[model samples]
Target: MPIHERSLIRPENLVTHENLVIDGVDVSGHWSTFITSRTVTDYNEAMEEEISALPGGEHINRCWQCGSCTNACTVNAINPEFNPRYWIYLIRLGMEEELLRDKEILWQCVSCNKCTYACPRDVVPEAVMKATAHWMELKGHTPKSPSTHFDESFTGSVIATGKIEEGQVMRSFFKKTGQPLNQPWLIALVRGLVLKFPITLLMRLGLSALIRPRTSGWGRTQAALNDYVSEVEARNSKALGLDGKGKH
Candidate 1:
């Protein structure tokens, strides 16, 4: 079966016998594979509400299993396991355990907005993925993902200077993620760019590195943004039933 069409039944719940005979009927090998029945009694009833409390999760309740989000998802094209539709269903049903099966890759959404555009109900699967990822980190289900670190680094630079400095953002992300600056692909990319357009690339890089980009007279804007961010954080924390003082 295609990954998207695969049954939700857990593999461990499947029972198979090499040979079996019951009442003049022969059931062996392939025919013997049967799924064992099970009950799910540990649903987290607050799952939907808690997820909805997060910034990107607001529209999650509007999903209707239309599959448009998953169909339009760029990440899902590469990895069918990253099905936004399925995750939405699981979330709405409070199947927290089932949802966690794909937790590690939840932050892989590229925010292409294709899912958002294709959704008839404005489900905004891209935002939903972001919210679910944030929810995972906030609830301590997983450590902060590298993507989250990159986002923080990028956003911090933007908020601090009212503009993004690519070199700074890259360095900060690498430092926060404990990654080496000399990765093979990165080296190749830089080499290719320099070889193709040495003078232009060199001047641009030199100038950008020498003088960091910043918005003029951005202090007031930064202060206002900081205040708005703090207010939003407090509201998110309260919605999740957490102390407003918790670290974001």
Candidate 2:
């Protein structure tokens, strides 16, 4: 099959370098505002600072649409709609709305660093996926897929307990994602795997109670979440037409 007809934008049009469009919106008034709201960008600088800070950042500036990065990304290889190359292009160009809305396309990543491992210049598209997930979360947006919950629930349990209690985390995650505990067969399968390893079985049965993890202090985590809440509130206020988008 031919490639041109399948693409909405030709590969040639992509900017492999770090240039911005001067006409539509200046970086300050439009780009930085949208970027900062998502925590991926600071008011003074874009992801370029982080990208350039990477030892590979110098060549990242030279990525001239050869599709090397895109060809390297597993997400793009499987899903024709995904284009890591263009995503980086969007970040560089400061297409604010487009960048924010990009969050709607989620769970396309499997956290595989094959693209990063394969990059000749070390662009680290896997890091970009991580950045995108954090940015999306800041905007009060969530992925439709359960993969995220699969991680967050476990991690949240860890954050709360300093170690994961498999049984507790499973119940918590299932409740959050609206998934029920597995049927009897599934539970049996899991127990069978555990019981086969006596040491692991003893550990799972709470024989290691003396070494159980203690929780972290709540003061600092509360402060962090409070800051995030404030940022979301600020952005959502403007989103409700406070940014003069609704004055008419």
Task: Tell how far residue 222 is off in model 1, in angstroms.
Answer: 1.0
Per-residue error for 38 in candidate 1, Å, reads 2.0
Give the per-residue lDDT digits (tens) of candidate 1, residues 46-130: 9899998898888998988989988888999999888999999999999999999898998898999999999999878888889
Candidate 2 versus the native: TM-score?
Answer: 0.51
Error of 1 at 77 (Å): 1.5
Residue 192 miss distance in model 2 (angstroms): 6.7
Clashes of 1: 0
TM-score result, candidate 1: 0.87
Score every model by TM-score: 0.87, 0.51
lDDT of 2: 0.57
- The lDDT for every candidate, in the order shown, is 0.87, 0.57
